[model samples]
Each structure stands twice: as structure tokens, then as C-alpha cells.
Target: MSYVSSVFQRIKVRNANEPEFLQAVEEVFKSLEPVLEKHPEYISANILERITEPERQIIFRVSWVDDQGVLQINRGFRIQFNGALGPYKGGLRFHPSVYIGIIKFLGFEQIFKNALTGLPIGSGKGGSDFDPKGKSDGEVMRFCQSFMTELYRHIGPDVDVPAGDIGVGGREIGYLYGQYRRIKGVFENGVLTGKGLSYGGSLVRTQATGYGLIYFVDEMLKHNNKVLQGKTVVISGSGNVAIYACQKATALGAKVIAMSDSNGYIYDENGIDLPLVRQLKEVERKRIRSYLNFHPEAQYIEGCKNIWSIKCDIALPCATQNDISLENAKTLVANGVIAVGEGANMPCTNEAINYFLENKILLAPAKAANAGGVATSALEMSQNSMRYYWTFEEIETKLKNIMVTIHSNAAAASSEYGFGYNLVAGANIAGFKKVADAMMAQGNY
Candidate 1:
């Protein structure tokens, strides 16, 4: 067997129950055959084995009291996957779906995603099983305090820095940072990336991922002698990533017709009202179905998955992992989706990705396409370290430049390997080579 296949077999056996992690590993390994063929020493040095395993896995019990005065216990985890480039960096997701396997999957993906940005940050992921959906502010704050009390010890400004994901956002980051400050008694702003502007938060951080996804897509289109202008875009999810993707795409002259939430999706043929989306989501924290209250002319779909059936020039699945199934991919291709960009990590399943590739749909993989968030997070870290901030225009420009570079690099790598613009393989090869070289240079830890 080839080295890549051999290593992946072992990973599957060891992580048999971890389907998400297994899927992530398999996706990455599939693209690594070319790399392994060229660098046989990597196999001898066991770089894949070491890189596949996390440097540290932290699991802790978080005990807190709810608003009803009842004590609640939740599990927290932090998988520091790799740090060859720099400190362990990723996000803390606070959903009930969070588990060891999910954290491992996210952390594993982060290793490459961070590397694609060409940033001096490694990959790690953390989260708790605590669902903050219906929790009161007091309850959430108490839970964050307890969670951070354990997490703070394992992270530092120059160590492992975490931002936000799924359930963790500006509010959660504030609570976590406040607790970390209370514990450490120091103004270590660089320890967190998604803080509020009143504190040390960087401008354009919230819009980075979404804006970055669109920017990368724009670059992909430009490479194919196309542009986002006049394109009909359908983006899944109405959170930070989706919201800003809509904003940026609309600004770039694409008509964003649809956006979604966990509950359902909203379709506005006249293009999504960016301000109203911001109002409904960011301000009111309401369901996407509530969008109809203002834009009565718009259609409200009851199921989010059905949003993929809408015909559009571009499809961006920014919701969650494995959101786009094979059926969704078929529907998109049948409806003539010219391009698909993963705004969420592993949003497209392996089958879905294959269908897209087989149909010759232009695809921007998540690692290279949606890397804007972490890239901006790294920018935030730099500003925090310098105790200074850049203007929104300046930060956005830097983010655009980075996304363009990532797209070009992935395209170049794909062309070099004769993949004919297979960004999936290109991104994997590009990101893995960097981490692999760094690991080799550092020797065995």
C-alpha cells in the first residue's frame, strides 16, 4: 500500500467511531498521494502519524449554576492539533453537537486551514456540550466563567489563542475573556481574537470569513474569465459568515437571493436586504423566518436543506459540516450552479464534492476559500500584540490580498500536480507541504 493509504488505514482503525474526524482525515489523505510520492522521507519520519495526532487533548468538567439555581455540568474539550507554524489557534464551538470526535475533526481541518492563510498560527479546536441557545445571560455568563476557568490555564497570549465558532460569538468571547482576565489579573488582549471593539477586538474580524469567502470566489471566477457581477448567489446560513458573505457579494454586484438559519431559509429575489438581515439576526437574534415580517414580498421556506434546490449561478454552503449531501450537489448541478464555495468547514460531503468535480463546477475548498476568519483572527492577534488597530478598509484590503494569494497558490499547486484546477487536491497539497516542512525542520517533539 502507498504511504498515504497506509497512514489513513491506521487513522480509520484508531478513530473508527469518529466519523467526522475520519472523514476529514480521508479527505486530506486522498490529496496527499502526490506529496508522499515526491517526499518519501516524510513517511520514514512519521510526519503524517505525528501530524494526525494532536499535540495535546484537554478535557475538563465545567460545573455551573443555571438561572433556576440548579447546578449543571457540561464537558469541555480543547484539541491542540499542531503548532509547528506558531501557537495553537482555532475557535471554541459551544453547541450540543460538540464532542471529542467533532472537536478532533474541527481541529484537524484547522491545521490545514491555518496553514493555507500563510499565517504564523497552528491549528487547534475546543468547545463544550453546553448549548447556549435558550440559556439566560446570567446562566450563560456563569457557564462561560466556569468553562474559561479551566480553559484559561491551558491557553496564553503566545500559546493557544481561540476565537469564536458556531455557538461562541462576541458575547461568549467577552464572557470568556472577562473570566480569563479575572483569573490571570492581566490585560492579555492577544489571548482572544473575537473580542468587542470597545475592548481590543479588531475591525473587520466579524466580516472576515464571509468577506473572505466571497473574495476567494471572486478570484476563482476571475481566473475562469468570469466575475461575480450580475451573478445570482445562494448562500446557506444567516450567521456571521453568511451575513457578511451576502453583504460582500451584493456589494460586488452579485444578487444574493437566499440565506438560511437552523430553523429555515429566506429567499429574496430582489436580493437580500443586508441591513434587515443584520437587524433580524445580529440585533434581534431572531429566526430567519422572521425576515418575512419586513420583506413580505420575499418567500420563506420551511426547510433549510431545500434552499439548495433554488437555481443560482453560485452556491455557498456556510451552515455546518456535511450540510450539502450528494442529492444537494446533484440538484445544484442540475439547476446550473457554476461555482460552489465552502464557507463552512466540510460543508460539502465527499460525495457532494465528487459530484461537483465530476460536473466541472468551479469549487473553492473551505481551507483556501473560507480562511478569511482565521486570517483576520491572525490580523487581530497582530493588532493586539502591537496594542494598535487598523482601519476597516486597511484590514479588508489585507484580507482580500490574502484570499487572492491563497487562491493563486492553490491554483498553481493544482496545475503543477496536473489536477487541472482541482482545488481540493491543490489546497490539501499546498497546506500539508507547509506544515510538513515546518514539522521536519523542528524535528520530533
Candidate 2:
């Protein structure tokens, strides 16, 4: 192998414990192989290693009192990976699956995702092992308050900005921001994003990720002189991202035939009723199987993986990481999928990604495609700083523009490297150049 490849292999060996993080770095490096060979300065700087490792990692205890007056504690973490562009910005996830490895991987991906937004935001990710799934509202509030009690000390307007991820949403943000406000009495709106509308949340913050996923896919289609109109689509995960993706697909004249949750997937050969989906998932907090009760024509499969076999023109994996594997990807390609936009972080495996790329499918990586969430969070921060709230239409328009700009930037980057229409190369080269230039200016750290 060449020297650049050798350096990456060494770094991968040294950081073998973080499979997801290594997978992310490998994808970018493979796409940048040509550039690395041309620029010996990059190899000499060892920029890849510096860029991969977080500058600061903070892990703390979050002990809270439940409604039973029982005491519980969970681990919380914040990995500030890089700040070459601006202040550290990312989401805080609260789920049982969280750990140091997951946090680091998310943080590393956030670095490039934020960079693609073309917004002045850095990279970080944090959250707790505090599962809010079955807890009472009171219990969740107490846990969020307790979690933010310590987190508030570490975050501020200029220091680090945290938003919502997996298990953290409007409810969690409300509790956390309330506690932060009560403790500091400053009412700094930019400190936390994904807040309630009245409390300074951006109008489209809730819809950004899913809508942006569609926007990116639309761009991918347009790149090939195609569009989403009259296309059949299948989306995994019926949470915020999945629900919104369904809505946007319908709005774009695409028939979203299927949507799934952790338990299973619901397929309606006819277009999915996003309104009913919102009722089942958002208001009722139930599984996707229940949707069959409303629409008997819809079929419910008992596993998420089965959704991939459904024939479709486009697919958006908006669920958790590694939800799609080689087997599923092969099935998708065989079924004639033209494009995929990842709404969830690292939703597909390395093998699956290569399969898609090699097949000439339009693959929009999570860092470049699903950046709508963080980009809207940054907008929320701006609104918070100004103590002003924007209308839903206004925020939605701005969000659309941001996604279009990101698509243009990635496309331009791909063309610059003579890898026209290759989004992976575009994102890696564009994101890496920004962070590397900043690090060079800062000297070290």
C-alpha cells in the first residue's frame, strides 16, 4: 500500500475499539486517496488523526429523583471533536444504547455534517444513558432537570451548543432548558436547541432532518435529470425523522409506501397516510403495527429488515445506525432503488455503502445529507440570541435553501476533484479542507 494508506491503517489499528468512528473515517479517506497523494503536506501534518480525535471529552454522572422518590444515576458524555470553524455544536441523545463508543462516533460524524451545512458551527456530541421511553412525564422532567444541572456548567452561548437527538426532543429540551434557566437565571436561548415554539425553538426544527433528507434526495435525482415525482419510496423508522420524511415525500408527489419502527414495518401499497402516522407515533406513542388497525389495507411485518424487500424507487434509512446491511442493500439494488439519503447517523454498514456506490446509486452520506437537523438548531440558536421567533413558512424556506446550498457545495467539491457527481468525495474533500485549514491556522490543539 501507499504511505497515506499506511498511515490510515496504522490509525485504524490503534483505534479499533470504535468501529463506527473508524468506518466513518475510512469512507472519507478512501474518497480522498487521490487528494492525499497529490498533497504531501496533508500526510506530513497527520491531519487525519488530529481531526478524528476529539479535543476534549467530558463524562459526568447524572443522578436524579424519580416520581417514587427513588434515586437513580446515569452516565453522560460530551465529545468536543473539533472547533476549527466555530463553537462546538451537536445533539444530546438519551437512550439505553449510549456509550463512549457511540458518542465518539456521533461526534466524529458531526464534525463533517456541520461542516457541510456551510454554517459557522464546530463539532461535538453528548447525551446520557437515561432512557425516557417508559418513564412518567414527571420522572422524565426530573431526569432532564438533573442531567442539565451539571451540563449547564459546561455549555454556554460561546462554549458549546447542544440540541436534541434520539430520545431527546421537545419534551426533553423543555425540561433541560427550564432547569438551565432556573439555575443560571440568564435565559440564554442559544445554549439549547429543539425547544418548544413559544420558548424560542425554530419553526421547522422539528421537521428539518426528515425534510432535509428528501431535499438531498431530490438534488441527487436532479443530478441525474430525475426527480421524486411519481416515485415509490420506503422509509425506515417512524420517529421524528421518518414521519417527516413521509410527509415531505408525499408533498413532493412521491408515494411513500412503507414506514417502520424498531418493532416492525408497516407497508401500505397505496400511499401512506402521514396524518394517521403522526397520530400513531407522535400522539399515541405506539408501535407501527397498530397502524394496521386504522388502515386494514396496510401490511405490518414483524421486523424492520423486511422493509428493504419492498419494491421502491428510492429509500431513506432514517432509523439508528447499521439498520441496513449487505443483504438488505443487495435486495434494494435488485429492486431498482435509484438513490438513498441517510437521515439517521451511519444507518448503513461499510459493505452496504460500497454496494450502493459500486452500483452507481446516488448515495448521500449522513454527514452531508442529514445535516438539516443541526443546521436548523444553529438557526434556533440565532433566534434565541435575538429573542425572536420565526414563522413556520419562514423557517421552512430557510431550511430548504440551506439544504440546496449544501447539495451545491458537495456537487462542486466532487467536480473540483474530478469525481463529478460523487457525493462521498465531495463531502470529504469539502469538510476536510475547512477543518484542516482552521487547524493549520490554530497551529495545534
Candidate 3:
């Protein structure tokens, strides 16, 4: 067997129970065949083996009191996958779906996603199986404090910095930060990102991922002799990424037709009402079905996956991993999708991604497209280190530039490898090359 194939087999056998991690590893490995062929040094150094194994896998018990004063215990994980480029940097997801396999998969993907940002951050991911939904504010605070009490010892500003993901957001970050500060007895804002603006948070960090997804999509479409203007967009998920992507796409002259939550999706033929969406998901924290209360003319679907059936010029999947199946991909192609930007991590299945690329749909891979949040998080780290912050416009301008550079670098790598428009390979190669070289320079760990 070839070196890539041999290494992949070993990983699959070793992580047989970790289906999500295996899927992530297999996808990146498929793209790295061409890369490994060009750089025999990578093979000789055993970079693949070392990169596949995390530097440290930390699992701990988080014990907290519920509102009823009953003791609740949850499992927490922190997999510092790789730190060759810089300090380990990723996010902490707080959802019931979180587990070691999920954290490993996310951390593995972060290795490339952070590399694609061209920033001085490495890869790590942490979270718990603790569901934040349906919990009282006091219960959430207690959980966050208990989670951080164990997590703070394993992380620092220049060690392993974590931001928000999925269920963990500004409120969770705030609660965690408070606990970390209380324990350390020192102000160390750099240990976390996604903080409220009053507490050394970057101005545009909240909207970074969604806005950056649009920025990358705009550049990708522009290179393909197309524009987002007059395009109909269907964006899944009603979280931060989806909301801001809608705002920016609408600003860029695209009509966003559909957005969703886990419960359901709302389709508006008159394009999405941005303000109403923001109010519903952000302020009200309600299900997407609530949209029908204000706009009776719009249609509400029962399942979130069915959002892809809507006809649109661009499809942005901002939901969770494996959200789009091959059937969804086929439906999108039949409906005339010209571009698909991923605003969430691994939002598309490998099969779905292949179908999109096969049909020449301009695809912005998740690692390259959804990197805005982390890139801005790294910027937050820089500001915290210097004790200074930039204005919103300054941060937004820097973010747009980074997304454009990522696109140029991915496209250039694709063209160089003779992969043409296959940005999946391009992004993987570009990110892997940097991390592989850094690992080589640093020697074996």
C-alpha cells in the first residue's frame, strides 16, 4: 500500500470507535495524497502518524448543582490535537451531543482550519455532554463555573486558548471567564475569546464567521465570473453564523430566502427579514416556527434538512456537521446552486461535497470558509496581549482581507496542483503544507 493508504488504515484501526474522527481523518488524507507525493520528507518524518495522534487528550468530570440543588455530573473533553504552528487554539462546545469522538473530530479539523487562516494559532477542541438548553441561568452559570474550574488548569493565554462554539456563546464564555479569573486571582482575558465587548472583546468578533463566510463566497463567485448580486441564498441554521451571513449577503445584494433552527426552517419568498430573524433567534431565543407569528405569508417546514430543497443561487450550510446528505446535494444541484459556502464546521458530508464539486458548484470548503471566527479570535488574543483593541471597522477590514487571502492561497494551491477548481484539495494541501513544514522544523515531539 502507499504511505497515505497505510497510514490511513492504521488510523482507522486505532480509532475504530471514533467514526466522526475517522471521517475527518479520511477526508483530509484523501486530499493529502498529492501533497505527500510531492514532499517525501513528510513521509520520512512520520508527520502523518504524529499529526493524527493528539499531543494531549484530556477528559475530566464536571460536577455541578442544578437549580434543584441536585448534584449533576457531566463528561468534559479537551483534545489538544496539534500545536506545531503555535499555541493550541479552538472552541469549547457545550451541547448534549458533545463527546470525545466529536471533540476529536472538531480538533482534527481545527488543525487545518487554523492553518488556513494564516494566523499564529494551532489546533485544539474541548466541550462537554452537558446540555445548556432548558437550563436556568443559575444552572448554566454553575455548570460553566464547574466546567471551567477543571478546564482552567489545562489552558492559558499562550498555552491553549478557547472560544465559543454551538451551545457555548457570549453568556457561557462570560461565566467561564469569571470562574477562571476567580480561580487564578489574576486578569487573563487572553485565555478565552467571544467575551462581551465591555470585557476586552473585539468589536466585530460576534459577526466574524458569518460575515467572513460571505466575504469568502463573494471572492469565490467573483473569480468564477459571477457575483452575489441578485442571487437567491438559502442559509441553514439561525445561529450567529447564519444571522450575520444573511445580513452581509443581503448587503451584497443577495436575497436570502431561507434560514433554520434545529426544530424547523422558515422560507420567505420576499427574502428573509433580517431584523425579525435577529430578534427571534438572538433576543427571544425561540424556535424558528415563531417566525410565522409575524409573517403569515411565509412557509414553515418541519425538518431543518429539507431547507436544501428550496431553489437558490447560493447555498450556505451554517448548521451542524453532516447536515447535508448526498440527496441534499443532488437536490441543490437540480435547483441551480452556483456556489455553496460553509459557515459551520464540516457542515457537508464528504459525499455531498464531492457531488457539489463534480457538478462544478463553486464550493468554499469549511476549513477555508468558516475560519473567520478563529481568525478574529486570534486577533482578540493579540489585542489582549497588547491591552489594546481596534474599532469595528478596523477589525472588519482585517477580517475581509484575511478571507480574501485564504481564497487566493487556496485557489493558487489548487491551480498549482493541477486540481483546477477543486478547492477541497487546494485548501487541504495549503493548510497541511504549512503545518507539516512547521512540524519538520520543530522536529519530532
lDDT of 3 by residue, 1-445 (tens): 9889999999988999998898888888988877778888999999999999999999999999998889999999999999998999999999988989999999999999999999999999999999988899999999999999999999998899999999999999999999999999999999999999889899889999999999999999999899999999999999999999999999999999999999889999999998999998888888989999999999999999999999999999998999989999999999898999989889899999989988999999999999999999999999999999899999999999999999999999888877987778889989999999999999878
Candidates sorted on TM-score, descending? 3, 1, 2
Task: Give the per-residue lDDT digits (tens) of candidate 2, residues 204-241.
Answer: 89999999989888988887899899999999999999
lDDT of 1 by residue, 1-445 (tens): 8767888899888888899999998888888777877888888789888988999999999999998889999999999999999999999999999999999999999999999999899999999999999888899999999999999999997899999999999999999999999999999999999999999999999999999999999999999999999999999998999999999898999999999999889999998888998998888888888889999999998989999999999999999999899999999999999999999989999999899999999999998899999999999999998989899999999999999999988988888877888999899989999999999999888
| TM values, all candidates | 0.99, 0.97, 0.99
Which 10-residue window of candidate 3 scores lowest in summed lDDT?
Answer: 30-39
lDDT of each: 0.93, 0.88, 0.93
Please report the TM-score between candidate 3 and the true structure: 0.99
Runs of candidate 3 exceeding 4 Å displacement: none
Instruction: Give the CA lDDT, 0 to 100, for residue 347 in model 1.
Output: 98
Better of 1 and 2 by TM-score: 1
lDDT of 1 at 317: 96
Model 1, residue 395: displacement in angstroms? 0.9
Show pairs that collide, candidate 3.
none
- CA deviation > 4 Å runs, candidate 2: none
lDDT of 1 at 99: 92
